[model samples]
Target: MVVRVFHTATALANTLAADVARALRSNPRLVLGLPAGRTPIPLYDELARLHRAGRADFRRARAFNLDEFVGVTAKHAGSYRAFMRRHFFDRINVPKARVDAPRGGARDVERECARYERAIARAGGIDLQILGLGLNGHVGFNEPASALIARTHRARLSLKTRRANAPLFGDRVSAVPREAISVGMATILEARRVVLIATGESKAAAVHQLVEGPVTTRLPASLLQLHPRAEIWIDRDAASRLRGARAAALRRLRRSRRGRSRGRRAAARARGSR
Candidate 1:
């Protein structure tokens, strides 16, 4: 697991977007696991900007959303399908047919989930999965629990999650679906690379737990700690509550940067003096 801290949201977005572009360049057919939420908007926006700049291309890539409201369809204004189209897909070159999102409105939900998993296998698994940290440390609606589901499955949404998504439903928390179809924890862990991003003081506690806390099913995100290739990107506000070695390491990194800056300035001054 790797943690990257940025001083500002823009810095974080730019850095991560560059990383994504590099990955896409490395594998033009990269399969992506994407998340939907306010936290990832900046990154999506940056990636779209990168595409426009010719720094990245998505025409050959495929994408799968992390989750969707159980009873919702693509036509719903607040559906994740709609969200991705508005925030990302419409702005990039990726074809609409190449994007695969769970069919929450399918007549046979279980069969639909099985089909989604099968589709992933046919595509050779996901190359990289982008995620967002929930206020409760949940990942893709895999809420805090004694044990988490292992594959793509239907999950009950926690009240907090519904409340968080209320704005999408016209600020009526009750309008938010109480259930969702999500890629399970085990499925997420299987991805070749995982990138979880968080920002703002509201996410400080969850970010702290994700980085320094114990690995338990209670906070599903802590499972990322066990993944061999997980990258966490967050800004100073989201990293505010981290402590112990994690905190010290960030401090040391800052000091090293300052030292390098001063040394470069001194070298330039000496050269001018000579």
Candidate 2:
């Protein structure tokens, strides 16, 4: 697990876009697991910018959304599929055929879950998975007490989650679905790389729990600690509660600068000696 702090959300988004662009350059066929919400909006915007600049291409890439609300249709304004289309797919070159999300309105939800899992397997799993840290520390709707090693499945939405998402449903808590289908913790852990983005003070507590607290189901994002290549990017506000983490990041930054300075000085001295 790696935690990186940026002064602003835009900076964090830019850095994440650079990483994603690099990954795509190295492998155009990369499979990306995406999350929808305000936190990743900037990142997707940045990627769209890169695409327009010809610095990135999504034509051959595949995308899978992290989760979808059970009662919503793909065209619903509040659906994750609609969110992705509005924010990413419509802006990028990725073919519609190559993008997928859980069938939130499927009559056979259990079968839909199983089919989604199989689809991921057939794609050889996700190369990079993007996540947003929920206020409750949930990831992909895997709410608190979610099994540590579960696979793609249906889950009941917690009331807190519904309330938090109420604004998307026009501030009507009753309008938010009470259930969702999410790619499980086990499925997310299978990704080659995972990037989690958090911004603003609203996310500080959850981000702190994710980075510094114990690995427990009570804080689902804490499970990222077990992922081999999990990277967390947060703005200063989101990292406010992690004073020790902030200090450590600053120290590392200083050390890196010192190392670069010493190398340049050594080169200058070598030239003078010559």
Candidate 3:
């Protein structure tokens, strides 16, 4: 596990975009697993900028979203599919047919999950999976008690997830669906690479636990620790709770960057003075 701490979300976003661009260049057919939430908004915008500038190409890439709320119409603003379209697909050049997500609002949720899993398999599996961590350490919609489901399937939402996602559905917890379809732990762990994005002090404790704690069912996101290639990118606020030595080292790295920026400015001023 590699932890990179940035001073601000904007810097983190830029860094993530650059890494994504590098991934695309290395593998044009990269199957990207996308996440939806406030955490990745800036990163999506930055990727769109790269696409517009012709620095990145997503036309041949395929995308699969992590999860979607059951019973929510895809046209609804609260739907994860809508969220992905609004933040990413609509802005980038990914082919519409190649981008797939589980069908929400289906009469048979189980069948939909099965079909979605099969589609991913037919497309050659995901190459890189991007994720957003919930404050309670849930990833996708795999809540705390769902350690048993080893394959892709539908899930009943936990109370904590409903509460956390309430704002997305007109700020009413009652309006948030009680269930969702998510790509399972096995699917995410199967990816060639995994990138988890988190921000804000509200996520600090959870981030610390997920990054260093034991891989347990209680902290579902902690399962990433078992992945062979997983990277976590977080801002300083979200990394505040890491242990002493690690936190101190991160601070020193930030300070070093600041010092270099200050030296550059000082040199520019000295030239002007001459």
Candidate 4:
């Protein structure tokens, strides 16, 4: 696992977008596992900008969304399908046929999930998977549990997950679906490269735990620790509570800068150069 901290949400977004664009340039047939959430909105916009400018070509790329609301159709206003179209697919050059997602409203959601799993495999598995961290430490709706499922499956959305999704449902928690079909942790770990982005102070605790805590199932995102190429990308606000690794060095740097500032002030005072 790798942890990268950026100065601001925009910085993280830009860097991540560049990384994706570069990867796509290297492999036009790249398969992407995408996420839909507040954190990825800017990323999708940046990728669209790259496509429009002809900097990155996605014409041969294929994409699979990480999950969708179980009760909503793909055309539903709040479905992840609509979310991706509005935020990403509609703006890129990738053909509609190549971008698919779990059918949230399928008559048998579990079957739809299994189908999605197979579809990903048929596409030769995901080359790159981008994720957004949930406040409760989930990735792709794989919530904190005693054990985790390895294949795409129907999942009961946690109350906190529903609340977090409320904004997309007209800011009404009651309007958010209680169930969803999410790609499994094993699938995400299987991706050749995985990057999880988080921003804002609300995610500080979870970010801290992901980088500084144990690899326990209670914190599902921590399981990324086992992935060879999994990366946690966060902004300063989200990394604020972290205490080890680069976080400790950042704190020390700040204190050193302050000390130098104080020394300069004292020297100026001694020279009567107020």
Candidate 5:
């Protein structure tokens, strides 16, 4: 795992969007796992801009949302499906039918989870999975636990998440769904690559925990330690706690590399002049 810390959320979003755009170029039929929340809004907006500029091609791309609230119509204003449509799929060229998300308000949730998993399998699994970490280090609603589940399924929301998400539901905690269906940790880890974006000081503790702490299900995002190709992009505020002598030393090493590269370029220019 690697961390790319930016000074602002917008910069982080642009960087992440550029990475996704590059991935699309390599594989036009890329399957992306998307998350819906305030964190990823700027990223989606930047991606939309790239698509409009003809720098991104999503015509053959497919998307699957990370999770959705139960007990709500897909058309509901606060639904994840509505959030995805408004923030991403609506602005991009991804076909409406190819953008898959679990059906909410389904009387048979077991069938919903099964069918969602099967759909993902049929699509050849996701090429890149984007994620947002919960305050408790949860990833895609797989909250703190002693063990991680390995498939798509429904989960009860933790109190902290419910409280934090209340404002999205008109500041009515009761209106927030206690349950949501999420792609499991195993499913997320199966992606060819994964990108986790986080911003704000409110996310500092979680970021520090997942980056430098133990790989325990108690902090679900820590499972990334086991992933071969997962990267995290964070803003300065979110990385506040990670600042230290060791980080400063690493920064010095990076600057040294840049200085050497610049020196080599100067020598090459001098030779050309001669």
Candidate 6:
């Protein structure tokens, strides 16, 4: 796991957009796993800008959302599908046929989950996954105590999760669905690369737990520590609790800069002596 702290949300979003653009440039058909939430909105905006400038192409890219609230149709104002379309899909060149989300209102949710999992497998897995840190360290809908290696399934939303999302439903906790269909932890860990973005002081504690806490089911995001290609990008406010980690990263950066400077100086001296 690599942790990068940025001074502002825009900086974090810009860096994330650059990485996504590079991936798409390298593989136009990349299968991307996307998350829905405030943290990723800025990144999506940046990606849209890149697409408009012809710097990034998404015509061949495929996307799958991480989760959707059960009982909500795609047309629902607060549905994750609606959120994605409004913030990203409608703005990019990606074909609508290539975008998919779990069927939140499916009568046979078990079958739907299986089908969605198969769809991802058939698409050759995700090349890159974008994630946001939940206040309680949940990823997708895999709340605390969720099975560490579970696959796609229906999840009963925790009260904290519902409360956190209440504002999206007009501040009515009752308006938020109690269940959701989510890609599980095992599915997310299978992605070729995972990028998690977090901002604001509300995320500080969860960010700390993810970066420095032990790998425990109580903090689901902590399980990313087991992934080989996971990167965490967070704003300064989100990383405020990681004092030691920040200092260490600064020291390593300084050393790298010093090494480069010394190499240049040595090369110049040798040229003059010659």
User: Candidate 1's residue-wise lDDT over 39-83, tens digit each?
Assistant: 889999999999999999999999999999988998899999899
lDDT of 2 by residue, 61-143 (tens): 99999999997999799998998899999998999999999999999999999999999999999999999999999999999
Candidate 4, clashing residue pairs? none
Of candidates 6 and 3, the better by lDDT: 6
Root-mean-square deviation of Cα positions for candidate 5 versus the true structure, in angstroms: 5.3
Instruction: Report the error of model 2 at residue 56, Å.
Output: 1.1
Clashing pairs in 5: none
Tens digit of lDDT per residue, candidate 4, span 1-274? 8888777788899899899989988998999999999999989988888888898788899999999999899889999999999999999899989999999889998789889999999999999999999999999889899998888998888999999999889999999999899999989989988999999999999998898889988888998899999998988889889875677865765677689899999999989964
Q: Tens digit of lDDT per residue, candidate 5, span 1-274?
A: 8777776799889988898899999999999999988999999999999999999989999999998888877989889999999988899888888899988888998899999999999999999999998889998889887787788898888999888788779999988999998899999999989999889999999998988888898998998988899998887778777756535744665567689899999999999999
Off by over 4 Å in 1: 252-274
Error of 3 at 217 (Å): 0.8
TM-score of 1: 0.92
TM-score for each candidate, following the candidate numbering: 0.92, 0.89, 0.94, 0.91, 0.89, 0.89
Candidate 2, run of 10 with poorest lDDT = 245-254
On lDDT, the stronger of 5 and 6 is 6
lDDT of 2: 0.91
**On a 0 to 1 TM-score scale, where does candidate 6 land against the true structure?**
0.89
TM-score between model 2 and native: 0.89
Best by TM-score: 3
Model 5 misplaced stretches (Cα beyond 4 Å):
243-246, 249-274
Off by over 4 Å in 2: 146-149, 248-274
Give the distance in Å from residue 189's predicted Cα in candidate 6 to where it truly belongs.
0.4
Residues 131-228 of candidate 3: C-alpha lDDT, one tens digit per residue: 99998898998888835476678888888889888888888999999989999988899988899989999999999899778889888888899998
Candidate 4 vs. truth: CA RMSD?
Answer: 4.1
